[model samples]
Target: MSGLRVIPTRRRGQDLLYVCGTDGRNVAWYDREAARVHLFSEDLRQDVLDALGPFLAGAVTVGPPPVPTAAELVRLALHPDDDLAPNRPGEALLIALDRDPGPAHRLRTDPRRRELAAEQTVGEALDGLEGGGWRTLHSIPLPGGDRVHHLVIGPGGLFAMYALAARRQRVVVTDPLVTTGRREPWPLLRRVRSDAARASYALTAEVRPALVLVEPARLDVTGPPREVRVLTPADVPALARLGGVLKPADVEALYAVARDRRTWGKG
Candidate 1:
């Protein structure tokens, strides 16, 4: 007990202090967000508390961890390599940039960097909805070198969202075609719907498609896209206001299935 160490770590933007024994096995962990110290054993309760004395703030709960839910059990059973929960926004691009950063000095900024920024902005917004009973997964890799920028599940139902880096450009949407600034129109909505369809196939559930434009100067929709929902970064939080399509348990179940890398591989 004298050799117990308190190690600090961060997970999902939350601070955690882990109390480890001399053998480096975790005896307890303090979740700052929950203001609780989860103990692995009752016998070591006082020892764990003593080890965390310097870090303890106000009143805090000291007890065994709660029973794992079915979703949590599934998540726990997954191998680290197969877990998609840890992926940050634009994870693939982040990896690629890390592998080859290209010329140190560039004539113009990398388009990938702009795409990454857009994903991060939208990803952070989606992640904020977690407290309101939503679950989001970022940078889900599909077969054929494609990816779903973000997958969101909540009372609003499931949506596969694609982030566009429109920045200060005007965006025009006409069916499957999308035009940004002076750029030529492309069938972007087709890809958005296709990604959603793949997600639906993989999860065996209804997955809607959404296009999120980041910081577009203006958005014009000549005619609403068939089945795709168009939005901007500021509009993401509105999804939390939607309900009746799913229950909390359903959201967790779908999230558990979706976070497995194998789930997308089959699609």
Candidate 2:
């Protein structure tokens, strides 16, 4: 008789919290209750709900509702999923952040402030990493000292995709960051013929964009977008002078890059 076999395995649960923003394009994952809320637009919410409905078990609210008693609010916040017995896949309760139909200014007030602070902390963290010889590769503009040398690290052959996306979409990728040099080649980029297609592949799949930016040396871009580009990593003082003048659109654009690289199948 064959010997009994044993295998080591791990199950997936709420090891991470995924918060899809009100923007149809933004999806952020959190591991801790930091002082920020994940923002996702209504359009994307539908997609995320469909994808994650199987795991999420709560009433994920998008806007403030009628004033409830303190006790009620606590109950709702704690047992948000009670209304939907087993809040699993195909039974998710979603609310659009814009469902209230309020002024755009009001809509952005809270979220923008929160993101601004987060972005600041992110920038500081990236700077520290770079100082320690860590390369920061992002399609978004990093607010560091002048000579903004950002590296739009692609998944290998996707350099052309980013270049086209930036130019055609009028996406401002201010300065260039160097791609992390990879030892092994990615088969997907080698097989694909178009840059747009490559970008699409990267967007839906990549989970940690900020990490990609800071630690390119550690990643092995074996999935796709194999063709990497070294953008103009110069002119730092000017970008630094601008300070924290980030627009929501700019934030969205960064998401665009992220989405393009991590995308999988169509909606």
lDDT digits (tens) for residues 67-141 of candidate 2: 334564343332332222222111111122234433657634554333233333334433443232232333221
Q: Per-residue lDDT for 1-267 in model 1, tens only?
A: 578899997654778897876744566789888899987567888999998999998999998554447667655568889999999999998999999888989999999999999999999989999998999999999999999999999998889999999999999999989999999999999999889877875765568899999999999999889889999888999998999777777787788888999888756
Q: Tell me each candidate's TM-score.
A: 0.72, 0.22
- TM-score of model 2 (CA atoms): 0.22
Residue 50, candidate 2: how far off, in angstroms?
A: 3.4
Most accurate candidate by TM-score = 1
- Tell how far residue 63 is off in model 1, in angstroms: 40
